[model samples]
Target chain A: MPGAEGPVGPRTDGGLGGGQRPRDRRRHILGDVFAVVCGAATLVGVVALAILLFDVVRDGVGQVDLAFLTSFASRFPERAGVKAALAGSVWILGLTALIAFPISVSAAIYLEEYAAQNWITRLIQLNIANLAGVPSIVYGILGLTVFVRALGLERSIISGALTLSLLILPVIIIAAQEAIRAVPDSIRQASYGLGATRWQTVSRQVLPMAMPGILTGTILALSRAVGETAPLIMVGAVGFIAFTPSGLGDQFTVLPLQIFNWISRPQDEFHVLAAAGILVLLALLLSMNAAAILLRNHYQKNRN
Target chain B: MVPSAPDLSFRSGRNRNERIIGAILFLCAALSTLVTVGIVGVLLTQSFAFFRQVSVVEFLTSTQWTPLFQDKNFGILPLAAGSFLIAGGAAIIALPTGLLAAVYLSEYAAHRTRRILKPLLEILAGIPTVVYGYFALTFITPILRSIWPETDVFNAASGAIVVGVMIIPTVASLSEDALSAVPDTLRQGAYGLGATKLEVSTRVVIPGALSGILASFILAISRAIGETMAVTIAAGNLPNLTLNPMESIQTMTAYIVQASLGDTPQGSLAHQTLYAVGLTLFLITLSMNVVSQWILGRFREEYE
Candidate 1:
């Protein structure tokens, strides 16, 4: 009503300004274009990922029979299986988890629950962040010098696992800290008021509450360790081990290393085998991630 | 009601256990610290040994990198340049696309859209870098060759594109978290002033989330810089000091990998050079991470 007043300006055919309609139309068109562009980019990215997965699955599924799962690498691509690599991955994952989990969780607990506001804690926190960003290859070199060469561990699973454990420790610590920090302070106070000791309160109460997050983080970190190639390569993991590792001290090859060896070969058949290896690796990664997701979901449901 | 004989003995026993557990936790924290210190010590020691044989000037300034040659030129410039060019190209391709996708996911998309999009995006991150390396070598390189016949079969462009795709999820996920952290009140205020949705989002929300966005970008850059397998498999092993993305190039990580393939003799200058490169890569990434954490710590207080 105020806009229509004669004192303000001459009357127009509509309430909108003469230029407003075209501007609004232009904006709507621009918005649509923007939305379309964003949607397309996202869609394209997802499609590329899907295509990669599809190629791997298509090529690898054919080689994933029981024999392939159980047998060692064969002289022929047709006869080759992932038995050695699978066992190596399992061993590496088991050892890495064993080494990294306790240390990472304990560090997180200390930082989140016990540590006072002080410079030492700040320094430790800063170092953890920096460590997390160091390249896997750098960790590999460290492993080569410290574990494999300096300790004389040779090209064994122990060195690989230890290197991987170090590589993933920062990730686990960060994630565990986040989980611990998410716990409400009221629970701690309640436990303290009941005359429960700090250990009892943390282990039975805070830890149980943070279990799912910790597990998820550990699983994700282990998954990353499984896929990692650089550190293992540096730690002297063999590329073409025909026999399965007999023990922790024996030389081993992982799926990624095997795939690299195959892909680097001049033969097209080796390329196919590499694709198949990728599928196997993807399956392993997906299963582990799915388990983590399930655990997290279960925890969330019970937590509420 | 009188609590007759107080349970002081039991309480004291429990307190002793708690102290024991606390000691164990402290040990674990120390262990985590030890891992960091151990890595630094081992890398520095080995690198120092390498530097004794090869002058820092030669490592930093030499253009040629034919370590296997009789002449043994050990300049790191070619690998460093390759790493920089590939990472820069990846950043150029990933940044705008990732930021746009993040904006859509955090600002414009509905909850359902976001839920679907986020996990789909994460699938990109989960794909093994080795698989991406294969994709670059096979699919992307072939495509590039179709357009540019002069392009090498193992070209930096293919590696850069695949690496960009590989990093998009990381950038998008972190940036989305950043954008979503911006307070709603500022957005509401913008809306009350009659700003359009796009205007409110770009002008108000993005500015509010600027620090987080910058952190995400820095983190993405760090990841790109540290990436190994994809570049190793896609970019050829040739350490050429050329700027052409269509040609084969080598990264620092790739050179480390090439050195670790059992060709370089132990205690040789080339072997030690790997550690030196590792140290440089570690320092670069660690500094980025420290800067990111510092930024987050400083700015997070302002928001909270």
Candidate 2:
């Protein structure tokens, strides 16, 4: 609370026009208070993040052994592990990436490279932005209707993956578009000068240049998909399962759902287990993000 | 239709490949349209069925949200209230914190500090909501309980706080871009008038970027409203119309999960309510998205 006053609290206010204003004292106090408040507000993010990471690591470090990674759900808190949920999450991630990547990248290519500055293209652009902001839970309902029941996929990993793909498609597309758009026009002209076809220019020149950015975006999108629970819950991610999924058609529970089940349990031990599950989930997310950052940094370096 | 600008196709051997690729990409671009249609179509069909079964008055006017209860009260107000409770608290926490962070990031931070802090915030943003949920349930609630005994474990206060942390990056990063986008000339003019750093930032920068900042706030609010996992875990599932953030409540998104997570019959009223809630969620977010887009466009045109 003491630090809430902050280092930039107008401690050394220079005289305005070599004379203090009529309400100089009041103005100084007000400015100091305002800056302090803003500084404190800014501190909340950094502080909250530190505390979250510290707490999760401290509480969950005990549960990081191979047994915890290899076992499935158990009635006993000590015995419960994340094997089935982890496998299901991997399956979902792979499938969601497979379903979403090609479509999103190709869509980005078409919109950025081929589409004219026309009303229809503008509408599609607007729709993509809107879709990016649509609630993930709504996508869950769409999946429930289209994939689970209408398409008759049931509570399968594929249904969940497809749902998440839609949920994150807008994000991937927008990122990919930005990535593709960043490719210098001179490069395209150079490719054309070599007598390449449009497809050749796009696939060979544009895509190669944009690959790192696209991969970064895709990895980040997939990281988001990994942490998502609501859509999967709506898409019928089971809370507890005895066996790992063998195929896309099998019923599944992802890590978040598993963690959710643990947190909802009445026992204190379960809460601790939830902490452990969170650590694992964080590990997965952190690695993906680290990869994305490295990829982006590499791209920036190459661009420079 | 072929792209009229054919510079890249100067020596197309086997134009077949280019046409096929172009057609596929076009279809890929059109998938977004299909997704929009599918979401709207799914929500409407079931919402109509729900309206047919349950009177609109009962669905709108009543204060209870017990669609799955034996008595089966279908009032949406309670759920909306719950959603608003957490979302409003989230807004309260996020707006000031996020906006302030944005100000600091844009106006105050040095190059190295910016590099470190920005990526740290990205990590915060990258964190899964479910992990935040666990943090809320296991850590934040207990801390709040110590401060106030009456604060329940499954109260909106923790959910709101965590969701606020989750959104700080959104509000900060977007609004920072907005604040920084304010022409440096404006800040220099204020500085020439002997304005302090605090005054220049608070008055010149924030006001110059007001629309963009407003867009960020609206987008963050919509994100809070649509957020599911953290809110669901931290705010318990009991729909009672109340303004208190300490009370147990079920949000619209949570209800969708509760209804569908169980094996609710495909044609059951409970199942239909899922779509109705999805429709409501979709409408709320879609409108916010439109408003955000309009505000962002105004901001862009103003500066550009």
Candidate 3:
């Protein structure tokens, strides 16, 4: 619909008036070239992703089996399994979700519905933003000192979960805040009009409306925690554990850490094992993401 | 109104319940602020202990970072240089490609194409960084070895390339959001002025979204600097002070990982170095994030 100014009114003086500008033609040609280049630039991500996936699958797909899933890590690539790592990942994700969900959602609710507009609120918001941007490795140091040493939690699943919960708290809080804010103010007004208290309105109206989005965000954050290795390592998760963690106080190893250990070795077979480990981790991450996306889509479709 | 006022005290119990719930939620929100304080507290105390052992001048000016070795030098330059080298290389790759991809998505792609490509990019973004690390070590390193023949088993170039690819989705999506935020009327105006599509995209939309684009760039670079697994896997643990991408180098993050992977006694100087490096990393990224947020806030154009 744009560029609709009609061609120069019919060349009354007519010596090829509309057709003879070489510079304009060159400009158009340049524009066309740029468009092609831009499209190609977009394909860079596609190509990289495709190649990475293909490479991982080619190397590791043969290694994924029942044995690989059941055995503990071994020096021999063929004998190594992800049993301990998988179990640890499950434990961490579950514990992290349990610890982080309530805190993040309640924080979101407070910031959205209770915090007054003032400098203190602004500062708190800014601090949350900063914390969200702080590197995960920095949080690793914090975990090492505060959780592992000071609190004497040692290198355990609960410590790892607590550290990861802190790492992801800001992300989930921001996401939950967005979801809560999307609930219409009229919902709150209606609840109040019905003699409901403020907490009652939020608990009965706003939370349900926002639950889908909050869950989606929380699920995504947990997946991120599952992928994280640096903070876990800092908190003493670097042991060569031969068994799955039996309790929160037990030492643990997650998939990414196992993968890191494998890839760091010089043997090509270890690399293959790393690739397989990667396959499992990616499967976990992608499925979690897919579920979140599905939930979001389902809710959106229902709303529409 | 007077009749309603007669029974206001009947709701005291509910009001008290609401106040208690509100306080709980407020504490939940305050936990984020507490986390920030905890990180600062832990970093400062540990870094102070490290500095007491190793002078600040030595930490700042010494050339070597062999803290783990018998001949210990505590200079941070090598690690800092390595981080900058990877970040610089990543910037060279991600900035142009990401911006161009954003331009294409914002200005040229059809709706269906955008829909398909956007999700693909999200998938790319969501892939675990450790998986990216695996790809960098196994896939990109092999490719580089074949091409350059002088590439190390672990080189900065390979890490940079993978980190760049990992961040492309981030830069593309954020920049696209900024470009899309530019009003359509501006595009139509440019087209009415007889500007070609590329010209309008470059000269109008991009400038209008400059702050957001810049913020995204800064954020992407911060991510590149703080990125751990991919760099640790692709870039070796040698803390070389040189800028050559072909040579293996260790980043500050990689150092933290390496240190954590090794057995160091608690409260030891070697253990304390992790906090020092982490503090430097945190300060760098935190400032960049703050500046990015400031740019977004200070210069954003509000459309009526």
Candidate 4:
């Protein structure tokens, strides 16, 4: 709060243009109060985050171990491990990436480079925006109906991955579009000047330039998919898979779903287990975000 | 004179490949539209089935949502009310704090301070909602119960508090972008007139970025309403129609998750209800998103 007043310039008129007036004093006091209030509000977020991290660590740190990473979930609180959930999450991440990445980048290329200014193009843009805002639970319902029921995928890992891919598609597409757009047009003109076709120019020049931005967006999107619970729940991610999934067709569970299951139990130890699960999930998220930040920084440095 | 007219064939092979690639990319772009169609198709068909069994009049007018009980009441009011309560409560907490934080970041914080603080706020945003749910249940719930002994173990207040914290980054980041978009000349002009920082922030910058600020508020609230895991975990499954934040309540999203967790046979009314509830949630959030996008577009165009 000490810096709430910011860097005050040397008083231009002896502290105030109208320091002798009571109204001036009140106005200055009001300014100081507002600044402090704003500073407090900003600190509120930081403090809340610190407390959350501290609380989870205090409850779950002791539970994290190699054994916890290898064993399957169990009814006993001490034995319940995150192996199945972690494996399923990794599977979801890889498959969602494989499924969503190329398609999203392609879409971004088409929209940014190929599409003309027309209503159809505008509608697609709007649709992507709306899809980005649709609740994850709704995407789950779509997955449940289309993949699990209609396509007979059952409660398989593939079904969940497909759902997550669709859920994150809009996000990736938007990010990819922005990245593509940011690729200076001069690069394309140079390629075309050499008699390169549109596709050739895009593939060789623009995409390479946009890769960092796209990967950062994709990592962030996938991290979101990993933390997602509701959609997977709808897509049939069971809470108590006795074995880790061996194939895409196998029923699966992810870390957040595992955490939810633990939290739902009335037992005290299970709550602690949930906290531990959160710690694991947060660890994964942090790494993905760190990678993104690194990529972004590298990109920024290259730009400069 | 031109060295026997250099071999400048049409190169139909390359042109064909280019056209093929273009079509494929266009198909990729069109896939997003297909996804939107798929969501609408699934929700409508299933919801229509649900409506056939439960009349719209009963579904909308009934106050209770006890579909699992023998005396089934199909009213959606309780679930909608719960979603509203959480979203509204979260908005109350996030809006002012988020806006103030944005003001501070844009107007008061020094360049280095803003750079450090912005990413810290983003870390809060990047955190998974499930973790927030865990924190709400374990940390915030206890704190609330200590002050208000009447509070339920799973209360709306804790859910709202955690969700509000979760979205503070969204509000702050978006609003800071808006606030920063206002031309520096406006602030300089106000400073030249001897207006204080607070006066310039409140009267000049805020009004200039009002539409963008409102859009962020709407998007944040929409996020709060659609928020699933945290609310589902912190706010219990009791679909009670009441205004008391101390009581446990079920949101529409929570209902979707709860119903999905239970194995309802295909074609059963309980299964159909999930789609119905999902459809309702979809419509509300979609409309809010559209409005937010509209406001954002208008604001951007104004600056352009």
What is candidate 2's lDDT per residue for A88-187, written digit by digit as tens? 8888889999999999999999999988799989989888999999988899889988999889999899999999999899999999999899899999
Candidate 3 residue pairs in clash (backbone atoms < 3 Å): none
Worst 10 residues of 1 chain A by lDDT: A5-14
Q: Write the per-residue lDDT of candidate 4 for residues B201-295, one digit (tens) a residue.
A: 99999999999999999999999999999999999999989999999999999999989888788899988999899999999999999999999
For A173-262, candidate 3 gives per-residue lDDT tens digits of 999999999999998988878877788889988998898889898998898999998899888785367998888899999999999889
Off by over 4 Å in 3: A1-20, A297-304, B1-5, B301-304
Cα lDDT of model 2 by residue, B1-304, tens digit: 2444555455254477777888899899989988999999999988999999999899889877777779888889998888888889999989988998888788877788788888888888988888888888888888888998898779988888898889999999999999989997777767666566778887888899999999999999999999998988888888869888877788888787778767778788987888888898899989998999899998899878
Interface RMSD of 3: 4.1
**Candidate 4, residue A13: how far the Cα is off, in Å:** 3.9
**Per-residue accuracy of model 1 over B248-297 as CA lDDT, tens digit each:** 99998898899899578898777787888888887777888778777777
Model 1 TM: 0.93
Query: Relative to the unseen true structure, what is the C-alpha lDDT of residue A217 in candidate 3, on a scale of 0 to 100?
Result: 88
Ranking by lDDT: 4, 3, 2, 1
Q: Candidate 2: which pairs clash?
A: none
In the order shown, the candidates' DockQ scores are 0.45, 0.55, 0.59, 0.59
lDDT of 3 by residue, B9-128 (tens): 776766678889999998998999999999998888889999998999999899999998898899999999999999999999999999999999988898999999998998898888
Distance (Å) between predicted and true CA of B85, model 1?
Answer: 1.1
What do the candidate models score in CA lDDT, each in turn? Answer: 0.83, 0.86, 0.89, 0.91
Name model 4 segments beyond 4 Å from true: A1-19, A294-304, B1-10
Candidate 2, residue A225: Cα displacement in angstroms equals 0.6
